[model samples]
Target: MTTLQGKTALVTGASAGIGLATARMLSHAGARVICCARALERLQIQLDEMPGPGLAVELDVADAVSAASLPDRLPQDWQAVDILVNNAGSDIGGRQPFHEGDINQWAGTIQTNVTGLMQVTAAMLPGMLAREQGHIVNIGSTQGLTPVAGCGAYTAS
Candidate 1:
């Protein structure tokens, strides 16, 4: 059990699934947790249920403007993140082959999973490097390694 007392953790896509679970675990371990998601109401509910200190921020990582402004939007106390969990991702478009899929959906998937992740990492990296202490955890899917039929965009992302 790694103790994270006095540390702060930021988790994206924290409105549900693995992101929510990670936020709970980090909070239980004594880290102040900041949950980021597009749905502020749901995020707040999750934060309220978690142990220790927690905050909820509405963020859409897929949106370049939103991603770029995230660092500036953080409250002073939560700005210096000790742990970053890049878990904001989704499979867009219905199950379909690459050629049959919606191009917009494919672009969205890429923007969120790749470009958005990079933006968030870049936004937070400077603070981490300056402090000389931090950890970044990128959540990846087995689908990325083992391509599955009808999930071309998701697999590619």
Candidate 2:
């Protein structure tokens, strides 16, 4: 296993599923993790389970205002993040045909999966660039590669 001693990682959508698993793995690998999600309570609970140091941060990646302010909002010690995992995603319209899908839901999906990912990357990239030693990992679904019916917004993202 590759050790990440003395490094810090930030994971979006970390309250559950893949995000949570990634955060736990990073912590176990020796990186201090910042677990971010819309649900602070759940995030905190997950953070407490990590084998290493971590912090739970409330964040809605779809909210540009919050995404833009994330870097500054982090504690000074956690500010110099060395790894970023852009894993927040949404499929608000579910598996509905395009014509039958709700436009509002489609918009929400786009905002979270595409725009939100970019927003979070933008917020973290500057620090990584300044430090000149960092890595970014973007988790994408198979839907992005193989077009599927009834998941227009998700596939597009």
lDDT of each: 0.91, 0.94
After superposition on all C-alphas, the RMSD of every candidate to the true structure, in Å, is 0.9, 0.8
Q: Identify the runs in model 2 with alpha carbons over 4 angstroms from their true place.
A: none
For each candidate in turn, the TM-score is 0.96, 0.97
Q: On residues 86-142, what C-alpha lDDT tens digit does candidate 1 reach at each position? A: 999988885886778888998989999989899889888999999999999999889
How many residue pairs clash per model? 0, 0
- Candidate 1 positional error at 110, Å: 0.4
Cα displacement (angstroms), candidate 2, residue 121, comes to 0.8
Model 2 lDDT, full chain set = 0.94
Q: In candidate 2, where is summed lDDT lowest over 10 consecutive residues? A: 90-99
- Which candidate comes out best when scored by TM-score? 2
lDDT top scorer: 2
